[model samples]
Target: MTGPLHEQSVLVVGRAGGIAHAVAVAARDAGARVIAAGRHRQRLADLYAGEPDIAAEAVDLTDEGSITALASRLGSLDHVVSTASARARGRLGDLAGDAVRLSFDTKVIGPLLLAKHLSPRMRQDGSFTLFSGVAASKITVGTLAVAITNGAAEVLARSLALELAPLRVNAVSPGVIDTGAWDALGDQAKAQYFADIGARNPARRIGTPHDVANTVLFAMTSTFLTGATLPVDGGEPLT
Candidate 1:
């Protein structure tokens, strides 16, 4: 337990899989105690069973009370990374009000509240890494709600970073990573989609959960870095 984050306490809030799980594992491997929290505590616990370094906790991002309670439970923390997002995908006419609201509530407002309650307990030298996405910059149809939510998240990171001086606040914006998020496209369709995106993007390949996890860890440890949205998106926005 003598890595860069040795003995530090890192909290990663999101679902059991995808980027959150990767981050929790990465942090633990880096010698930090990790807490993987989400809406379902038992499910998260089950997902991370037998992982001594990673303990599961419960927190409903849509509920302020839940965020407050989570903060109370962890009296002190060294760093926090929130990868929670509820995307509202569809055209303008197809979008539902509830879905859009939930998208913002989960990704934007939830992290804001996390900063509100957690900052008091976080070490001044600690940091918060919030999740943004390439959609914010790519700006294509069917991703309007997602883009706006991510845009707001980036802004939130900057705002919080300035307000919470010495306590770094940054964002990690990933491109189309090969995760369950794309499984909705079906096997063949998803493969084609990834292929198309990969062929066009500068990196020429889809990102992985580990790709994002590395950036999250960097954000936590890079003391000089703050208020910036680090893009893990294979330069997709440039195309």
Candidate 2:
């Protein structure tokens, strides 16, 4: 924490793992005053202790009052990225109604609330970036909540771009990133699955957290880009 983002302030929500973790690192390295936000206050403090100019802020996506309180604490923001998401992965019938609604709360409503409260504190060239997944394009079974929520996130970004004009709004749709999202599959099984999927990808490799994070950095700095959903999926869509 060295490039165009030097001295800029960026707040990345959902700093617990994977792509969000990498994005925070990338932004901090780019010299931005990174604010790592999540529901767990102690977790963020412990996780970001090794970094300089990175602060920890607590927020709950489902709670508007929590977001409002967090907003008052941040002085100014150059970029805001919400990688916050919740999903209940199972057949539609197996999932409860509350689970599906919660997914939308994290994926769609959370970002909207952020824009509502944080927009006023943003710089003239500031931006908001959201995280989405390839499930929006590649529909699969037992992932109904994931697919629907991610798709809605894309639309939310685009819609907000128009409403939050002059301030850019965009999303990164990552595909099969090696971000421990599949750790439940077990180490050996996860590795083999990645390799098999990589072989079919146009990029000839499954995505890494860095790949997605780099794209997020782009979305943050590219002033002319807005209402766009960039697919950093290693061309997995082609397969």
Candidate 3:
């Protein structure tokens, strides 16, 4: 899986588990050499310890120096998928300014910086896929911060598509996916939560990490696609 990507080197930046983990495996299966990058070194290594085809690297989005160094180290890549995000939740009036800045740093500014530095080293046919969320469109009292930041990701993707030109840029917005991202809720609560959400969805089921990861694959491999946000939310927005 890790031998020269067989296709192109795919750099997936985010935590070593959950959706990022799924994406890495999907990329490797799709014949791309997969480099799983994130801020946590141990987690990154642990995520791919036995996977010879997948590599791991450490990179932080908040630090420009870190990202710049990573960009230089990568030299060239065919696809870059940033699934890194700061989990956000708070009412509009209750959130702190610093929290807002950090949210944007992770979701919006980070990807912009990636395009700024990494785009230069990307192949003409390469693409950048960002992870947005259904929250970008479905705003609630508690998801105000997440909504704004995710909305910004969509905007950033569109603008980057135009600015980056030959290198395509797009975003994938997922709904309630059973990716273990909600494992903190414990098994019973998590199951109940997903079941509740699933019942309301038109698909009558919660999404899997593969659903979103598959979308990432399309964004990078489809030569004609660009500047679009593909929703893997299964009618969450429509509902």
Better of 1 and 2 by TM-score: 1
Worst 10 residues of 1 by lDDT: 176-185
Give model 3's clash tally: 2
Tens-digit per-residue lDDT, 1-239, candidate 1: 77989999999999989999999999999999999999999999999998878998999999999999999899689999999999999999999999999999999999999999999999999999999999999999999999999999999999999999989999999999987988987999999999999999999999999999999999999989999999999999999
Per-residue CA lDDT of candidate 2, range 34-67, in tens?
9999999789999888888888999998999999
Cα deviation of 3, candidate 2, in Å: 1.2
Top TM-score hit? 1
Between candidates 2 and 3, name the one with more favorable lDDT.
2
In order of listing, the candidates' clash counts read 0, 2, 2
lDDT of 2: 0.90
Ranked by lDDT, top first: 1, 2, 3
Ranking by TM-score: 1, 2, 3
The candidate, 2 or 3, that scores higher on TM-score is 2
Candidate 3, residues 7-91, lDDT tens digits: the string is 6889999987888998999899888888899999789998699986689888999888999999878868999999998866788
Each candidate: what lDDT? 0.95, 0.90, 0.89
Q: Decide which is better by TM-score, 1 or 3.
A: 1
Off by over 4 Å in 2: none
